[model samples]
Structures are given as C-alpha cells and as structure tokens.
Target: MKFSRLLAVLALAAGLSGTGASGAGAAERVRVGILKFGTVAWEMDVVRANKLDAANGVAVETVDLASPDAARIAFQAGEVDTIVSDVLWAARLRAEGKPVVYVPFSAAEGSVMVASGAPIRSVGDLKAKKIGVAGGPLDKGWLLLQAYAKKTAGLDLAREAEPVYGAPPLLQQKLESGELDAALIYWNFAARLEAKGFRELVSVEGAARGLGAEGQVALIGYVFRQDFADAHPDLVKGFVAASRAAKALLAGQDAEWTRIRPIMRADDDATFAALKRRFVEGVPSRPIAEEARDAAGLYAQIAAIGGERLVGPAKTLPDGTYWQGK
Candidate 1:
C-alpha cells in the first residue's frame, strides 16, 4: 500500500513538470532582424496597425543590423528568421547554400551617385575620375556604376579609374569636402548636401535605360527562411498582410513625410521635401522589369570584374532568383 502511494506522487510530479514547460513554451517569442531604414518604420506601423503578431499568436522582435554582409551572416547563422535588404544578397546567399525565400518589396531606389561642384555632369564624364561606391568587388553600387560607365560611354571601369569604398555618411562628407570626386549617395543624404551645392552626377533611373532598368529590378526586399515559412505559414501570411498595408500607407503624402522626416539625418524641411519628391514613393510591384534588368546588369558587371573568380557561369540573373511569396 505504501509503494502504491509513492507511485501516485511520482505521476503527479511528472504531470506538473510537463504543465510548467508547456506554459513557458507558449509565452516564448520569435526574433526578427531588420534595418533602421525608412521602409522598416512602415513595416513596424503596419504590423501594429493590423495587430498581426497578436492575431497570429506570435510576438514579433527586431534586431538592427548595420550592413548587408552582417545581415547575411546573421541569417546564415540562424540568429534571425527574416530580414529586409537588397535582393542581390539573397541571390548570393542562395548560391552559397544558406537559402532564404524573398517575401515582398521593401524600399525602392531614390539612391544614386552625386558629384560635388559638378565636375562630372553625366555618366560618360566619370572616366579616369575617382568614384565612390559602397562595397569593393561585391558591391551592387559599384557594379551599377561600372555597368553605367561601360554601356553608356563604352568606358571600361575595371582598368580606367579608381573606386573607393567607405560608409555612406563618410563618403557623402568626403564628397562635400571635395576629398572624393564622386560618391554613391541616397536621395535623403544627397538632398541635404545639395543645399551645400552638390549635384546629381548620375541616377538609378538613367541606368535603367541601358542596364535593364525597366525590365530588371534592383529594389530591396523582405526575406524569410524557407523552413521558418513552412513551419509558420499563418504567421508568414500575417506578415504579408501587414507589409501590403504599409505599402498602401506609404502612397499617401502626410503618411510618408511624417515617417520620413525623423529618419532623415539632415535637419531641414527643404531637404526632406526634396528627398520625398526625388527619392521616395511608388514602392512598385514585385515584377518590376526595369529593376529586374538593373539586377541583371549588376550580374553582368560582376561577370566582367572576375565574377567567375567567385561564382561560375557569370551570366545575368536568371528567373526564380527572387521570391514574391506563394
């Protein structure tokens, strides 16, 4: 009889332990990685506006990643479940075996290279002059600039000029101080410097003319791990719902400017207005022909600049490279 009583106590203890574990697991949250860029704010608002996490029974978390390389590394290490960044990194990641699915569009380019004092007026004039790009050989900005040089002016960027790599803030400062001849700059930063007399040397729009700007897309996108997507299908759908709503909200004047001003580094309304006019708006559809072509053009530039040295075939990005979610 005593042994029977001990058995009942052991069973009760096991049941209590199981119940405690289940409660803890239920309260756990999921971690998401993100950048502080403009689109991220839109996403944050949308998620809240739609109450996605609450509806889906999952808590959304965000980590601020400094660079594309760092984001890629984190995603590969499984530290993050999703990210918002350039699709170029996605293609490269899939090619390297750390696979992730492209979810939806993020920010479009109001990004370009600006020259101080207007020494370089057009794309052709960049020959033999130093150009500032973000990454060295692997930078999409460098590839775009090089392709523009080659296709528009027939100048070979690989041998003809010097390409400098630095952070956007530092590069823009150098451009303003006249330390660098030209620097790849976004619309917001470039507008702030325009008050100081910096001018557009070339644009992402112009590059679309020769570099598949219309047919090939180059905008940023939101990406999620395929396994995560599969495991949490309902949660993924909620995220999509939130992003679509954010894109709609971004189409409005008051909504966009209200969000953009705080993110603008320059402390001026005129700069914010100029950037809003010249850079933001029109988040575009997933299958942007010009953007896709620009992406392909980048691949071609990579091919010319020893892409095969890194990955073989060195051809333009084929179909299925981007995922628009199922």
Candidate 2:
C-alpha cells in the first residue's frame, strides 16, 4: 500500500508539472478513472467539449474501467489519479490507515420505487412485502431508507419486510415483473423507472430531510490521495472548479444533455428528459460546512444499522475526509 501510494504521488506530481520547458503554456492534466457508463463520463464529456478544465488551468483525462470496483483497484495501484466514491468508503479507508481527499461530485441520492398502479402507497404499506435493494445491505440508499422507516413509522424493514439485494438493473426488472413490492435503488435507475411510470414511495433525500438533515446531502465525491492534494493544491482546486463548471452547464442547458443522450442509454424521449431533470435537480447547492455536518450525522445513523461490516472501526466520518479547498 505504501509503495503504491508513493507511485501515485509521484505520477500526480509529474502530471501536474507538465513539461518544464513549456511552463505556463502547458495545462496541468488530471487522469480520472471512471466506469464507461458512470455519470462522471457525462461531466467529463462536457468539460472536454467546452474546455472547462482547460479554462480552469487543468486538462481532464479519463481512464475507462469495467466497474466501480475496477476503478478502485486502478486508483489504489497508482494507475490513475482519482475515482468517484462516497465519504463512507473514504472514511473506511482512513480508519484502516489509508489517507485520501474527497471533493463533492453529486448530491443525487436515489429513491424508493413501486409500480405506478400498486396499492403500496407509503413505506408502511411495504410491510411483509419483498423489497429489492440495490448495492446490498450497506448501500447508503438502503441504510437511509431503513433509518427513515424506523424513525417516521417505527417500521423495521429488516423484520417487517424481505429485502433481496441485487444490482440496480436487476432490481428494476424484478420490480417491473412483479417480483418486488418495492425497490430502493440508485438515482439513475429510479429515473429510468420513473420514465416507465413507476411511483416513488420515498426519495432517499426526502427521507433524509425527515430525519433532520438541513438540506441535500452529497454522498459520492471525487477522491484522491492526500499527498497528491498537498503536492498540487492549485491543481486539485482547479479540478473541483472545473467539475462545478461542467455541472453548471449541464444544469442550465437542454442542449448539453441532448448531446450526451446517446451515452445515457435512454430508450425514449421521456427517459431522456427525466434523466436530465434528475441530474439537474441533484446539483449540490448547500454550503460545504453544511454538507460536512449532515454527512457526519448520516454516517452515525448508517453505522448504527450496518455495524463494522459497513464502516470498519470509525462510526462517524474521520477528520480530514471531506476536502475544504481554497
């Protein structure tokens, strides 16, 4: 682990420095590892299309990976500078003695879904019904839903309902085929299901609000080693600014999303439009301090449910996990 981190630090320094002779003429490059279909790809396309990263003094490069787990492996081996992940996983790494820095990526927490015509009207209605939960028992969305059900209705999903863990697409299919009474899934899948006429039982974000979060919470983020940030503070900040700029463009313009629709895999116009709306609605608008504070509280809530299997030793977010850049 130490050796790999050293290699990553050195590689990042080289990527940031550019050619010594070119000086300011060359842009600081950031090689980000991402799943080919991950949402980060859409932002990278915008950043590259509009030269947002270059405008911010950085060049954005993407390394395509097969899966999120593959991206993590590549990131740890120093094959790439960063990957998109949540503060929970980052905190787990820190607690286990690895240091990293997190930059907010998106605030799109997913939703709980039921068939549009189903009789299940609320979370309480899901009692004794089968629920398909994507990302497993430790998935942040599932944990939040569990917390919400317990707090709002005193319904313990673990005992009152059956949860079958599976991938997002599979869960969506099962719900459509009547195999699942309700499914708590990732945002993009929820958007797709919405296009197919599914009704939301409750949004993870909405549940979070009921549980006392002041505003939207951003779970996923762009994470890189701390040493890399220390070595290239300006570059790291540039990446963050460029990301925000890409999001701004996508949020405001319908054309930007239209251009990326092919990659979105939206089978129809309704799905395409729904995805665009959900993505725009998820843009983080809260202050950094508030995001950090809410994240700490949410972590405690999930830790109480998932225990050591989910969070390792640290129940709350460890210090220095969330980045407050200059």
Name the lDDT of candidate 1.
0.56
Question: Model 2, 39-148: lDDT tens per residue?
Answer: 98898778778866655556666777788888888888888888899888998988889889887888887899999899998888888999999988888888888899
> What TM-scores do the predictions have?
0.76, 0.92
- Minimum summed lDDT over a 10-residue window in model 1 is located at 1-10
Error of 2 at 147 (Å): 1.1
Candidate 2 structure, TM-score to reference: 0.92
- CA RMSD for every model? 11.1, 5.7
Clashing pairs in 2: none
| Total residue pair clashes for candidate 1 | 15
Give Cα distance to truth, residue 137, candidate 2, Å: 1.3
